[model samples]
Target: MATEKRNYKRVMLKLSGESLANDKGFGIDPEVVYRLAGEIKEACETGIEVAVVVGGGNIWRGLKGSQGGMDRASADYMGMLATVINSVALQDALEKLGVSTRVQTAIEMRQIAEPYIRRKAIRHLEKGRVVIFGAGTGNPYFTTDTTAALRSAEIEADVMLMAKKQTDGVYDADPKFHPEAKMFTHLTYNDVLQKQLAVMDNTAITLCMNNSIPIVVFNIDVPGNIVKACKGETLGTLIEGE
Candidate 1:
């Protein structure tokens, strides 16, 4: 049986680098990447366009090593590379599964992927190709979450699906360490920012807040969750207009 088609003409999907791997939290996991690619393939077949923004936490996080004497610019550049690494993994996985994909980078690396081009990207999606956005907004001191927001606005996406490793929805506390954490099925953009939810950075929240882009936070570890979100299922926490 085919899944019901989603209403989205275009969507920006955010994947954490950790999703490319498991608890090891290092390199990309082949099986995980393939599964993700498969989901994306299905979504595209449903006639909904897809654009992706992947994070670099699995490779490196600027804040974590800021005290290690790394220059902010260099650390951020490394983070950007981490996103590229994950993007490449995703691209490869998708291609192997027969899903056409393009890897576009914020900071140009002509040999690997095309530099971010708004019109070209939209064209790719229009033609039913999946786009992987990497390099973290081409600037330092910005989270990839912010990159997703920036790119989503640039591409005029309908929604931003935030896929996490665990904890299917946004919560009041760290559900991993605190089992008593409460979940929010629906939340306002202000609620996320004022409450300082770790789901996204302030920069990202502000970007989405100003642009009015809806964000869906859900666990990617669950099979078909990506498709579920794309299909507009009321599964994850929705952060939008209050």
Candidate 2:
């Protein structure tokens, strides 16, 4: 198959932890990881620098832990560790596929991965390595979505890709519940904010808005969608400034 012309030089891909889970939605699914890694490798082959931020919801939800009576900070820290596990799993899969990859965490864990250094991460990207960011900004009370936005800005990514597990694009309502929910092919950052779309958390959306980074929300389960997004093939919802 012929590849499309690329549109982005560098991009940040935001993935949910559930993306690595199986049908039961718990723990790492090696099949899922390998499939996702294959798609990411294809995107990287397109000459687009890729950095990933993965959520830890499948392993642990800090909010859920806190609500269950654990200290919020402690729970959040556990959540951060979950992200590191996912990051390493992804790194392993990508490397097996012959893609050069790096896992950097906001929380230092030199034995497993490098600590997040903005300049070093950027240098890795420039050298054609896929960088995975873990630990969600090394802070409590922030979503990995926010980490994606922050990392996108720091890496000067041309676009941010929000990879949904099953959903294809941003909809006006939960499409699963609302079959008639409208999917906007194109949207402005204010459209997302004013309408309170669930595309991303407000902090993540605002960071992209402030940095003028475009975002593509698409279904990651669909093969080749990642590369399509990198090529600007319009398979998903695009959000940017008006």
Candidate 3:
């Protein structure tokens, strides 16, 4: 693939924690990690800078923990730790595939990974290293989706690639439940907010809107979707400002 034809120079990839879980469910699935790494390696090899934000829902959901009576902040902190674990797993997988990668956490954890440094991360990407962001804002009550938006704006990415586990694109309703639900090929940020499409949280959507960053929501179940998205193939719902 020629680099000049690619639409995006740099992109922020948001991966759900559930995507990393095996068929049995819960915890990191090495197979999934390796497969994802392969796809990402293909994208990076195209000369596009890539940054990733992974969710921790497979390991822990702070909201669920809080609903079960755990302190909200404490539960959220635990969730952050879960993201770190996923980030490390992804970093290891990418490295093993011969892709240079870096795991940078918002909260300091010098033993395993470097602390998140905005300029340092940008430099890494410029040098052709993939930077994986973990520890979601280093704060409670924010989803990795928001982290993706925040980091995307901070790093000046061309688009945010939202990798869904089973969902193919943004739909009028839950496609899993409603077989006839309409899948949107293109949408405006306002349309998502007006319809409450649920492609991402309001904060994430609003952040992208304010930053004028586009988002590509696509199925990650397919092996090469990530590369397809990086290649600017029309394979998913594209969300942007009107």
- The number of the candidate with the highest TM-score is 3
Compared with the true structure, model 2 gives a TM-score of: 0.96
Q: What is the lDDT of every predicted structure here?
A: 0.89, 0.91, 0.92
For residue 219, give model 1's deviation from the true position in Å: 0.6
lDDT tens digits, residue span 152-195, model 2: 99999999999998798999999899999988888999999999
**Candidate 1 lDDT, tens digit per residue, 116-184?**
999999999999999999998998888899999999999999999999887889999998899999989
In candidate 3, position 211 carries an lDDT of: 96
Error of 3 at 101 (Å): 0.7
Write out the backbone clash pairs for model 3. none
- What's model 1's TM-score? 0.95
Q: Comparing 1 and 3 by lDDT, which wins?
A: 3
Single out the weakest 10-residue window by summed lDDT for candidate 2: 1-10
Q: Rank the candidates by TM-score, best first.
A: 3, 2, 1
C-alpha lDDT of residue 59 in model 3 = 96
In every candidate, how many clashes are there? 0, 0, 0
lDDT of 3 by residue, 90-156 (tens): 9999999999999999999999899999999999999999999999999999989999999999999
